[model samples]
Target: MAYPIIFLLFLSLPFSSAKLNLDYYKATCPDFENIVKENVFIKQTAVSATAPGLLRLFFNDCITDGCDASILIASSAYNRHPERDANPNLSLSGDAFDIISKIKNNLELVCPGVVSCSDIVAQATRDLVKMVGGPYYKVRLGRKDSKVSDAKRVDVNLPTTKMTMDQIIEKFTAKKFTIREMVALNGAHTIGFTHCKEFSDRIYPKVDVTMHPKLAAGLRRVCQNYTVDTSMVAFNDMSSPNTFDNAYYKNILKGLGLMTSDYLLSVDPRTRPIVEEYAKDQQAFFVDFAKAMEKVSVLGVKTGNKGEVRNRCDQFNNNIPE
Candidate 1:
């Protein structure tokens, strides 16, 4: 799992170099990233869940159809089944969507229709990660918002908490991610919260032996009435719920990871060593995470005639009401 960061950088160059670059918006928006940063600071500071929410939003957007912000699209009367309407994405943070809209409206005030919502999702997510104690990574711009946002395309693309280690491996492998990259990407769970329904299976019907008794018991309390209180949720990282760090791996080591998938990563020999390395070395986790984000960010990106810069993120350029 000790893949060289230098080699990863080389592998990433192809995706980032052709149509995307660090300065893709330098001439067009001039202050694109700065605007994204400003909006993230304002909106994220007001909501404790904003940082992790936006990060998860990025994951949802990218993992399905690259980083084209398709997940941000609202289901219209004619298109009443956009990606956000998917069951897996039904729990996506509204604050995260609000932050992107905030950035979009603010940018339009100065840059007009120059910036793409897809790029905003990527940049704002990177800024938010740094805001909550994660590594600062560069995101290349120039991605155009996708014209597609099918909910049907989403369900199979998403990784759920109930997936076993083998299932998780298959999912990531289908996306071109290596086992080490898969483990590194899972580290993003460090800051996010999961709804009780997502993991109740792990704690109910007898707590799994791999889970610590105390952790299982506590989860029972939080999720006991989750069926009635759909909003009930728990943080993924027990050690530092809000901080983005290796505490997730540490929590897994102590049998405190909140999901079946998370617990499996600690015990699966193929992934456990990578998890152990991340737990012992925070920098390693950050470096690989940033790279994984980069790879995911650029996956299946749309360009040129394939995409467009949407004036309103919730609807496509042509779908905007006249």
Candidate 2:
């Protein structure tokens, strides 16, 4: 009896560890990643914002309840409020959700009920970064989609654009991200656009002295009557709005950062060094960003039998009672 119990424990060790790995789907779905990449390319070319949008989707998904695709869940009859309706997540591009759904549909055609939406979202994020000329890192798969999502949890876990560097650092650090990793992850801003309303406070009434005078003037022109036309937008990284590189950090160094949180990365004594380092070395930034992304992608991940692979990206498994 003792020997049998010890053998059972040994057999459970792999699942007990709960670590994700590159070959998670090797036996079950060999063509899984290629399919995700093809779908990403299709969505990305159709919409220029798709790349950054998907990347943002990955971050938001992970920060809340790990990268379990809870953010993709829509409100159902049982749960009237979902994470998607959260204030912080309100600005997420709808195209990202559509792209993930399309990819999940494609995967089901070939490997039905095998690839989880969580894994598909993770793979799409890596493909999107590579599509945008960023580092292509190996993603550990095997994440299961969450069956539950709450709006209140989103507000507690995510940092807003208006947060100070200390607040942002605290949030990321709580997730086991280092100060350096926090700074590197913020580099995702290199490729996205922000509405004028998100940053008008930095310029109106009194321009933030941290902003470069000329950059402030340019933003003022672009965001004229920002109070009335909140829809006006600007590139997060003015120099390389479409590229994923150290240009975002360079912008911060030059006082051209579009958000208060972004500008504070350079002004804060704790994060300034990492900002300056990444500003100077593109490769270094890429390496650290990839590591940080990989680490964050698996935070609080649910594996094994803890969650289920949803056939539809936007809804929970129908068989499971709400």
Candidate 3:
């Protein structure tokens, strides 16, 4: 009886010794939409009512270190944004800053010191999916930030709009993603818009009139006629531009993709089959997309007190004194 009692006590001790506290990720996500509704930036843009920029940052960081949450800061001011001399608003944007602030405030109100900024970014990313007419992604909490920030690192890690199939595969593969994962994740393009400066060369120097003629025409109209030369073009595959379904895959099938990286997914033998299947089934696209995104979010990440919870997502804890 003494032996049995001792064994039972040992088992109970482990459970009792463990600590469990809930935060925003552990609980249901707070009312993010209401928070967005309260944002001044979201109200300013004619089309910025949605906060996909946050989602973009989330995916961008998730590719490596399992969503380290460190992806939010400028690797170096050099790699930060405005990759070009011409585009001043390039690297960082007030829009993302505003959205991340709301996330921090809401989480603080509910969980106080418990929530991780990295986890908040991940959760905010998932929520942004629904905001822009896409599927919801499951977010794991407790990601930590890294003190290291290198512009060169980001330049190497991030995929450019100009990437070819091989280049994309190499980038994604480095991040533990497969060709199939690459195409599905690109479905995120379904709602976001890009500046003509990003893709004008694809249209002007070598126009593939055979494919996406109307889209090409639209691009030409804005890239050429508009003074901003920076006209907004719809992403996604084509048929269901706003919906986050498999229509992107179907667009590939019809040869109507907008970006080089996008078209390469279907044209490349390595990823073609997956694209075709997704084109056929929307449910399959959503399932695969969710899994791939989860894989992307957990790259080189730290969790739990490994770093400070940022008051602002754009920069690290200023109070900590760089």
Off by over 4 Å in 2: 1-19, 225-230, 319-322
Answer with 2 or 3, whichever has the higher lDDT. Answer: 2
Clashes of 2: 0
Ranking by lDDT: 1, 2, 3
Candidate 1 contains a number of clashing pairs equal to 0
State the lDDT at 39 in candidate 3.
45
Clashing pairs in 1: none
- 83-117, model 2: which lDDT tens digit per residue? 88897778788899999999888889888999999
TM-score of each: 0.93, 0.91, 0.75
- Please report the TM-score between candidate 3 and the true structure: 0.75
TM-score of 1: 0.93
Model 2 weakest lDDT span, ten residues long: 9-18
Report the C-alpha lDDT of model 3 over 143-188, residue by residue, as the tens digit.
6555444443556677777867778778888876777788788877
lDDT of each: 0.87, 0.85, 0.60
Off by over 4 Å in 1: 1-17, 320-322
